[model samples]
Target: MRAVRLSVVTAAATAAALAAVTGCTEKSDASGGDDRVVKVTATDSKCEVSKTKFPAGHIQIDVENKGSKVTEVYLLFPDDRIVTERENIGPGTKQKVTAEVKEGDYRIACKPGMKGKGIRQDVTATGSGKVAKRDPRLDAAVASYREYAQEQADETLPKAKVFAQAVKDGDIEAAKKAYADSRIGWERTEPVAESFGDIDPKVDLREDGLEEGQDLEKDWTGWHRLERSLWQDKKLTDRDSELADQLITDLTDWQKRVGKAEITPTSMANGAKELLDEVATGKVTGEEERYSHTDLVDFKANVEGAEKSYELLKPVASENDAALTKELDTQFAALNTLLDKYREDKTSYVFTSYDKVGKADRKELSDAVNALAEPLSKLAAAVVK
Candidate 1:
């Protein structure tokens, strides 16, 4: 009886020791011992681990969300496989997830919050049970943004031609009104305008002279020359006709220079859809804490596209399409105001945690973006029609 009691006590003590080491009751079968703990810290800059490579074994990943918002940690396998996902980890919270990793490469990504930014790190398994570190996904995200910028450039040019024709047909007022209506689709392209450089000069806005209260010299700048021309006196001469013809030729040349700045609503929708898809797939990783300077470019492109489109469609609205013209005019005015705000708050409209922004400021910024989309969408649909 004494020998049996001693045996039971020894077994119980061993089990307790194992639980203390593993942080769980289950014993690891991979290494025949529970000894490895992979610690990952998710902070402002990255998802970093003390070691980058790990050996094949039963491993415990202890993730610490040190950022301002909730974060999720995902372990990804080579075949686009997600070995495991842990979610809803609040700021400063720590959670431990265990996985049986074989001899292979794996990725670790942490998404801070819904619609928030994400970061990633790579880990390699070695023979001696060490982890290798790599963060290639960061570069991958930047490459993706550049590709998107090129795609936007490809879609803007043809649309500019239709816009110039509207101006040449002695329909400056109609053009002005239509330009206002096409803001949404144009705004998306605005973020990439600088990439195209001096393309707006191809659209000629100088054929008409300034009218009362509308000074082209005061208001006109590059692509915005069209808007400035709108308030000019409605008179045409032989010289003006020649100028208009020249303007059309210039616009065609500009379109060729800029490529296509006009991306259809369908295409814009598709791009947005792709962005959302990447976000959902845990594939969207980049530094977006700052307002994507690209957003400003998109804003400008949209303005340019709208200005050109308006030049083309203004006549239709003024003659046979009065109702459509009036609706477009109203939408464009609101959009112009929105663009003004964007220009003013270009650097301020960034994506950071609520904690990083003052309460009133955050609300105001969020409201501005939210307000613009619906009105912009309405305008885009009208212009496309």
Candidate 2:
């Protein structure tokens, strides 16, 4: 695990899956050439967004982290609905995000160290905004994605229970087998799971990701903690058994709350990119499932999630930007094909452990993820166009 990690999430808005959000079309002043581009300067303690008041359409957030620690920038609706966000902006690096917005009041938040409620700024999208003429296919994509999210949430609770029961029974080998199996749905729909803000940290947080003020012995709990007790410590504690029940309880909450999540087409496209980002930052590096070395399982799930998002929006994207769609198709196929090489168990969702992967193979996997992510980044722009 990296000592300094900035790649985490805090929800902006509701606690569920896909949002059919309200957005503005073209309501900003045409005379203000390029003024819609928001330049965000981030520091360890402060975040500044240039031209907080701008016209709304396809707005671009250009972020440069000048802080000593890694930070993140967000564009949020007044209700805390996430319009779009770019996380893991390491100190001294820059990242850009393009999102669709309606003319409305929004908040610009910067979280330095990726911790707590961030510095906030009020921004307004000025105009008598009209509903942008969006493709019907995009709307259809949103609907289909919502169904998919619900399906994952529905399937997860049962699998998680089996894993939890095994743990409670002190069935080490069964628990280990059921462990990675239980997380496939979660890793597949993580962006939706993360929309609830605190849920991800509660269920999936690794020890290395504990809050600065949290005590490891007391504050840290999740799949990773359980994995440590099972595989690393090689013994189960009473606390670990209790944690197993809590895991199911938390996921049960997630299952019931899935439909409550907000969904938008741009959010889906951006979520696809975020899934790839998770792979690059965590799973690809083998930090996510360190104790169990089941990183490949999560890695494949992340890729599948990203691919699902891309596939849903492909029809609209093909019409608006066929070239991008083609490249995405190629890259996605290549990545999946590459990942298939590691599947030793055809009967189940098992793969070679991440720890068993070599440096060259890992680099190859990283390259494949980046290759797909590049085209995936342009998806929101294409669909919104």
Candidate 3:
């Protein structure tokens, strides 16, 4: 009887110990597990998100496009600053974007057409790290650039109005002049301007993106479309005037929207290099202004835009590495000098005379742009360091 009692007591004590160990294992697993995954589906006009609450840390989202339209999923802050994004998701497909976020509120916006104010879903993240502190210098630089964008935006409105009025009145020569002149402001701020939903594409998309079976008579608009009417078709129709009015309205809206934009040093440097690339790919090849042959005007304007971006970030880059800054300055000056030879005046360049330019001259100009682009590429890294 004594042996039986002892055996039963021992068995009960072992069972209790095992239960305590199991409870601790469960607690540890809960504390250090995988990040919460959010599933999202995008349709024509709506965004459906699986989860609206998360624990702050590294989060992953699998965005499936269940719609007919091409879409982009963006994780934006309250101010519309993109935290991370997955772009160019085609129909019947899926892509993913992962970001390490602190405890705060975030917005998940899905742009179906890749243009327009998209459907947004709000999420609340709970964690120890909340709203990470930003570098003051970087913040100041972004603010300065935002102010510059506003100035450019204000500059574009009146000029764009004049250009539209010329098209409305059927004054071809005046309209052409205004078109080239007005584009300067738009080109200067193109990088930031492009973030403003549907308006940017309407204001500046190239002809290569036109839909299948879509043509001038069916679904073309904006600067390139007008460029075709004025130069290729040789007549600015009533439709052209209507499109012009729409462009003006869009630009006004863009001006307001850009006020909420966020800028970073990396983006600014990348914008500079991107403008040079535009010169190389389109302007140099004469593909951009196929109808008007106004490639030189755009080339000059692209250089101006690139120069502005480079100048804005030059201080930070120079502090990091003066040698790189010096090299970039020299390369930029060389490119500018080449562009100056084609200028007709302070605000204009001879777009028609591009055909007359010899092969050697074009090669020299192209080489100078390429030279600038190389050193300019490193500026972004320097600014980050």
Candidate 4:
């Protein structure tokens, strides 16, 4: 587990819950008896989604973790592609999320302890699968985000290859330098990458993200695995070289598939919040770039991606909730200003290693992240309203 240096809002509180599609959902009872709202009761072994069938548009999931561990909920396509998800739901916490789903077979999966494939319940959406008519600006926002995701994928492959080549050549110093650079594009468009269901685990999964009983030599083969070789292990292996090739292969698949991802204004809004959650859980905690201490680099990219989403949705969100937009603007500026102070080179993205950062400073960063996150949680609702 990553070290938690300060109190920060969990992903459930800061990012999860509200997601996808058009229209607001009517409130429902928390028990597994709600008719309109899809009430989900998650225990260690069971994931109970109240109604198996519902109307096609405006799908809402009201999740309560009656389990002993932190859990996650997902709306998955029949092929297991993630439509949208809410992660890090602590025991006894309740989350309400809404997503746009077309008429299709789907699964509501809940992962207790936030690990493994999760207990899944079959679900389907009935009736005309058409989504509610979205505003023109929201449509434009989806289009723009799709383009941005593609661009990030298009750029990531080459940079990743650079890191891969350095590893293949067994050049430790070069590999170290290229590692953080390659990850920037991935961090920027993480949500789009994650929508694929399979790619992120293959290309970016950290060692700790592995399921229980998974062998490191066999199961752990991604950026973090390679990262250990360059930094902590202080050595390279023939397997590391093979992993470098596999990383490129996985990324190539991601680049090819990005255009097919489902992008909605609400998804973008939810994704922006997810980015901030990454900062709080991984980057701010110094667990993401643990050996490299390049958390700040990833931190910056996450914020930039979140800001881009917010900016794209601002036109519509401001109209729906001007106060939220204004508060978000102030918070974003505050966070950015705080981050800038850590940068030794304002001209470049590099910053001081996180290990050098004091505990109080970390607390300050965590607070800034939480301050922005509270408003970010309302982003999906604002855009859809």
Index of the highest-TM-score prediction? 4
Q: What lDDT score belongs to each candidate, Candidate 1 first?
A: 0.42, 0.75, 0.66, 0.76
Ranking by TM-score: 4, 2, 3, 1
Which candidate wins on lDDT? 4
TM for every model, in the order presented, reads 0.27, 0.87, 0.66, 0.89
Local accuracy of candidate 3 as per-residue lDDT tens digits, 1-385? 0001110111111100000000101112112244466788999978998889877754567788999998878776665545555555789987655445667788898888766547999987777533324347766776777787788889989998998999899988888888877776777775444344455556675676554455645555677788887877878888999989988987887687667654555556655665675566446877666777777777776777677777877777799889999999899888887787777665555554577777788788888888987787667656655
Alpha carbon lDDT of residue 266, candidate 2?
Answer: 73
Query: Which candidate do you rate higher for lDDT, 1 or 3?
Result: 3
What's the ranking of the predictions by lDDT, best on top? 4, 2, 3, 1
Cα-based RMSD of candidate 4: 5.8
Please, what are the lDDT tens digits per residue for candidate 1 over residues 1-385? 0011110111111100010011111322234333456688986567888777766645677878899987767665543233444555778877766554556687777776522324777887555553223134322432444445454434434444444556667676555444432222334433233223333322312213222354444423323345434444444334444444454554444335333332222223222322222222221121111211122333334444443434343443246446655665665565456445544354432223323445464344334443433233232223222
Q: What lDDT score is found at residue 185 in candidate 3?
A: 72
- Candidate 2 residue spans exceeding 4 A from truth: 1-32, 77-81, 90-93, 103-105, 113-116, 345-347
Better of 1 and 2 by TM-score: 2
How well is each residue in 1-385 modelled by candidate 4, as lDDT tens digits? 1211111111111122223632223453122234446889999989987799987766668889998999988786655556677877889988877777667788888988776777988998787445657798887887898899899989989999999999999999999988988988888886444554467677767777766777878978778899989999999999999999999997898787777765667777777776676677656888877888888887777787888888999999899899999999999999999999988777787788889998899889988988998789887887876
